[model samples]
Target: MASIKAQAHHQRVRIRGYDVDIRTYGAGARNVVLVHGIGASGRYFSRLVDLLAQTCTVHTLEMPGFGSAPKPSHSLDMAGFAAVNCDALRAAGIGPAQWVGHSMGCQVVTEMALLAPDLVTSVVLLSPTINRGERNAVLQGLRLAQDCLREPPAVNWMLLTDYLRAGPRWYLRTMPKMVRHRLEQRIGGVEVPVTLIRGGRDPIVPARWLQELAAARPGAVAVELPGQPHVCMFTEPARTAALLREAASGQ
Candidate 1:
């Protein structure tokens, strides 16, 4: 994986009334767009992009408020985010490209597919958090309690700051909207080939959800990375890139 600073064509492009930061690498004929999860930026896909660039052109998007990008004045919801991506793709001259999204980005990609199915050739979802209602509340409670007791000072401090930025009020307001945004409903409507990626060790999004999602779609395929966690893209870049390439090639 190439470092973010080392990518030659790294630059910011204006899209959907926002300044979107994008990195383009390789000269392959097919174009692939990568989207990152919440509180993260395109840099998260640096390693995967470096590997996939060898076989296809790769474009990583830095959404508003993440990475070095500025936050928008208006609220950043899933639909708005998807529209921004659609506009960005059109502005960048990328058409009918394979959309690869991780976590929250997966929701965004699903929304985009719903809005403009023709603009997306296929989708590759990594650790998709679709059915929040089915999440293990007891496990979440245990993890919270454990983190409160054993987290290191530096890590705890960072967590505190993040919580402050993402205040209780903000979380309360945002979660309901996010929870109600149904990806499963959209999945059934997506006409393109869909591939779901799950981490074997992921606690957030269970393997069952992926299985159910794959089964809901006629030709969808699901792949699980053994011993990997929620951040499987980083932990299994080679495998993730392979899946992305397969989706891009329509194989």
Candidate 2:
């Protein structure tokens, strides 16, 4: 997820006693749902939403304990996160949508399809986190630090603000859950269409892992945004939205 200022309709939806904040944009025929990664709120996706809102009704969610949503009594693992999100969307009368996620959000959407298959028409994973080769926390942290050097100052600042909101405690409690989830193994089994996108300069989601994820599904599409960093959706909104729009069209 990345940040930019834009106007959107905000609504609050509660599921399992958790109040989730959702931002809706556009009035197009197709619906797209954007999910943010660990320690990120929907705000990081503001820029991309502006581009996507042009041709698709886009919804951005702030899951409990992350983003603007209040912290839960306990940190939720990937499955719990998916369950709440799935029910929230269904409650909002949004379903069978193009579910797109970035980083850990990708794992959440994968679990979403598994938990509520009918709710997701397709999945687009952008810069998916916890690459198989760098599952350890230290390695992941090092990679993130390395990736930060590639990101512009603005993008890094936005990510820092979001991370601060999440706080160290909740983030640490949730980190293992993200590292442990077998997204690479689980995504291949999803019944719906799957697409994988990564920045050519992304250290988190390696080129080899992207290829492996693509190979998992017979018709899966793997795309690389050359010269883009991990948070390309923010800096390269138009191009990112184009790929997302294509996926939403069932292409």
Per-residue lDDT of 107-178 in model 1, one digit per residue for the tens?
888888888887888899998865555544355445344534543344345445544544455444444455
The reply for model 2, stretches above 4 Å from the true place, is 1-7
- The lDDT of model 2 is 0.87
Q: Report the alpha-carbon TM-score of model 2 versus the true structure.
A: 0.95
Clashing pairs in 2: 2-44
Candidate 1, which ten residues in sequence have the lowest lDDT sum? 147-156
Q: Write the per-residue lDDT of candidate 2 for residues 1-251, one digit (tens) a residue.
A: 22323457788898878878998888888889999999888877878888777778899999888888888787789999999999899889996789999999999999998889888888999998778888999899999999999998988988899999989998999999999998878887888888899999998889999998888777998999998899979878889888887886783
For candidate 2, what is the total of clashing residue pairs? 1
Error of 2 at 19 (Å): 2.4
Please give the lDDT score at residue 21 for candidate 2: 90
TM-score of each candidate structure, all chains considered together: 0.82, 0.95
Measured with C-alpha atoms, the lDDT of residue 76 in candidate 2 is 88
**Alpha-carbon deviation at 52 in model 1, angstroms:** 0.4
Q: Kindly give the number of clashing pairs for every candidate.
A: 0, 1
